[model samples]
Target: MTSVVPVLNDSMVAGYLERFITEELHSSGFTEASIAVSGGLDSAVVLKLACDALGTAHVHPVFLPYKASSEESRRDAGAIVSACGLAWTELDITAMADAYVALEPGIDRLRTGNLLARLRMAVIFDQSKKEHSLVIGTSNKSELLVGYSTWYGDMACAMMPIGDLYKTQVRSLAAFMGVPQQIIEKPPSADLWTGQTDEAEIGVTYDTLDQVLFLLVDQRLSPEEVAQQGFEAGVVRAVERKIVSSQFKRVLPPIAKTSQRTVATDFLYPRDWCT
Candidate 1:
């Protein structure tokens, strides 16, 4: 399934997110922000957006590498920092991740990859605590809807600015922002274990899935309408099913009727109320 994404030349995604960063910093009363970058399109976009929004001086990129991870990850992560002149540091999780798998025998390498993700998040949270900054999250809409990420690992962030974009849109925006084409085009992997491709794990190309998602989710098109637009109904149904089944990931915990003014549901604030 192909798509017809018009070349995006202008948007405030960069500027808006920048403004958001500044506001969050001021309101949250923090001085800096930290993010975990894997040298993939998603994190590259996040890092670049962070640098643009907060200035490279205020954005810190932390790269966590495990033994089975690619050497290219560290190299390219440096490339991103040097390109943007952002501050960065590398942490090798080889020892820590190995110790985890050693105790939990029969855990597959992919599971180990997820553990590595949480380990990195622990480090990010620790750094945020030290720097007195917020930890930024990088999960795109495509990954979030499909439950493609570990819950408390990559999904955990003090605030997320890119959760609305689909994977295809993320890459498109990355190109608009002049993110390295090599990183943009690289096969997305958690780099947890050898030869792990997101598409290979999910069984559908992001391009194909996002197109179907736009029809089903954004436009509210019926499954037949989606299929009419050159996609399989099965694909549409599958993605929709996954979206429905994984609704918990996209939302805060359900509000129970404990009180008249509960937090997530009954006590939400309206837009502009804070200002």
Candidate 2:
């Protein structure tokens, strides 16, 4: 069995950005694209893409940090913004999470993390509304598949350029686009908890996970075929289980049975009525 690491070549990245800003940005009547810039590789790549797509002037990077999130993340987030010569602002969400936690002391850190994710989106969406822009998403396909992201939290977006790429592919594109090597090499995380790493939580490396996902999702491999491709049986089982259990996260909430063509969202919309 062979392992193929997925990649989005430099030209593909550039083309996506070009397609995004020209087709989405200008068409949306947005003067800017607002991003919730986390101090992580995914967001960094999104930022770089935004810069290339819309220029620094039209790409606004907003950093929203929770109290428990590391200061290193904060610094890293700011540094990338500065390095790219783009404008950014800080919105400390410590108070917001604290207020929610105060109301429900039993709330777990995951809850707070989701809250932070939603809050950041709220900020980005609001800014997009004000600036006549749209909220760009940073979620890669790897995270999206396993429901690793917040529901309406990090998942909210006017468009996602990298959501189709695996985590490894995201790194490839970011590196090719001249993103800092530090960012490209950093351990991936959602920064939901102190000392949290994505692989540690997910129990599998992105390389392995991406291979499984690509085989399963793209190639439509069966469980047996997937396991035969060099993945641990347990890893394949776990990934399959997560995918089944988390289908709701990837889609709209279940609506009650209704008459035909009910607007409970039987419609598949591209989010815009285009020209």
Candidate 3:
């Protein structure tokens, strides 16, 4: 009922994230991590956390930009790499994306954008293998909950340092970590197409959307209860629908329950089991 927005202690979260990254990497027997810096608040925060967690030497940041990507994306991403003195590489996926686009000349932005996202992930995974590091993800709780991410694309990662943090919380942590003000102030975007902002694509401001998500997901409130609390019934329904529809993106592909220990069915092993 109350329109109270969720607040996070940036300092506490920064420390917690730093420790989480270290522990996750250590348990996996990997001392290094590869991250795809998208020049957004979320990735910038993750980049800073990776540096604090494993040191500059252990963090490898890759800037994956395409032709449609804004120039600021590269500049902002490069600044983080320079500030941390971390070694990074850039991979221009324009040609690769064009190859697919050529197949379907009228392909919509969503399809092309998804292709680009997957290409970026493919490159990040390749770099991970080459650097002997795990792929660190930058997806936030807000995006993950609403399926605002691409499955096996931007959603792919060995471990997500900020997975539990919401988009608003990411901005808070980014400020605490001293990420560039430009990145923090800019409208959130995946940069899939020119002038495409995340809020515009999602059709709702993150402030309101996050509140709805917190009530529905974190507070375990039903859609009706959330609407009764003052949120628009339409907005509550939209958020709830996204959470249900996008559930598939949050987990491993389902396996048939034919065997006693089917993978991702009855048989699930901890990611650190091998370690």
Candidate 4:
């Protein structure tokens, strides 16, 4: 059967995203970008795009690794940095994360993972401040839709160049942009813990998940209709549930409207709004 997700014109997509990064940064009165490169496919692609958009010197890539993060992650992250013609910037979050982890005894993997992600977020923002650059996010549409990302952690960013692309599409784009093959072919992982992979946590491969997401979200098909298209009913419903449950991650938090105008409500303004 034909794939539900349309194959992207990688050259066009790359050119468009490069333009997007340049325009978004300039609009905000910034000329540089910082990204947290986790030795994963998404970050690798985003890093490449940023370097291409803003020049190697203008884009800073930092690898933030926890104690349990795999060595492969570190190596792959370094490879991408070299490929983009940038110097290596590494910050180990183990000490900081463990200091907090010690306070809460018996913290499960889930909570510890979140702590690590948020710590990385904090460090990356600080690094961006030091570099006077915006933090470019690496989240793709698949993670954003299914709520697979850490809230306020990996999701925190000034701009997301590849936010609209699905995970499968990201791989394709990565390949087209000459991202390291090992990074592109490896199983997707948050690297929160040793031997953990994204597909294992999401309970489905990206190939399956992206198709379901395209049918439900892009095609505007109901769950029932998606299942009719040869997708498993359970998988379709699970994907739908994730999209619904993770809606909060996709938007700004709501504020009570006691007055006529409130932040993110009636007082909405563009990021580049000037008085």
Candidate 3 C-alpha lDDT tens digits along 61-174: 999999999998888888877777876788899898898899999999999999999999999999999999999999999999999999999999989888888888788788
lDDT by residue (1-275, candidate 1, tens digit) is 23743334437667777687678666776768898888888888888888887787788888888887787777777777777887677788789877878899999766777788889889889878877778988998888878888878889997777788888888888888888778888888877787889988877888887777777777888888888888877878888888888788777777777878988767878433455
Model 4, 4-30: lDDT tens digits are 799999999999999999998999999
Ten contiguous residues with the weakest lDDT in model 4 = 265-274
| lDDT (tens digit, per residue) of candidate 2 on 82-159 | 878987878888887688789997898777788888888888888778777788899998999998988998999988
lDDT of each: 0.80, 0.83, 0.89, 0.93
User: Which candidate leads the pack in lDDT?
Assistant: 4
Query: In model 1, which runs have C-alpha deviations exceeding 4 angstroms?
Result: 1-11, 269-275
Query: What C-alpha RMSD separates each model from the true structure?
Result: 2.3, 1.9, 1.6, 0.9
Candidate 2: where is the Cα deviation over 4 Å? 264-270
Error of 3 at 157 (Å): 0.7
Query: Candidate 2 versus the native: TM-score?
Result: 0.93
Tell me the number of clashing residue pairs for each predicted model.
1, 0, 1, 0
lDDT of 1 at 117: 82
Residue 255 lDDT in candidate 3 = 72
Q: In candidate 4, how many Å is residue 50 off?
A: 0.5
TM-score of candidate 1 versus the correct structure, residues matched by position: 0.91
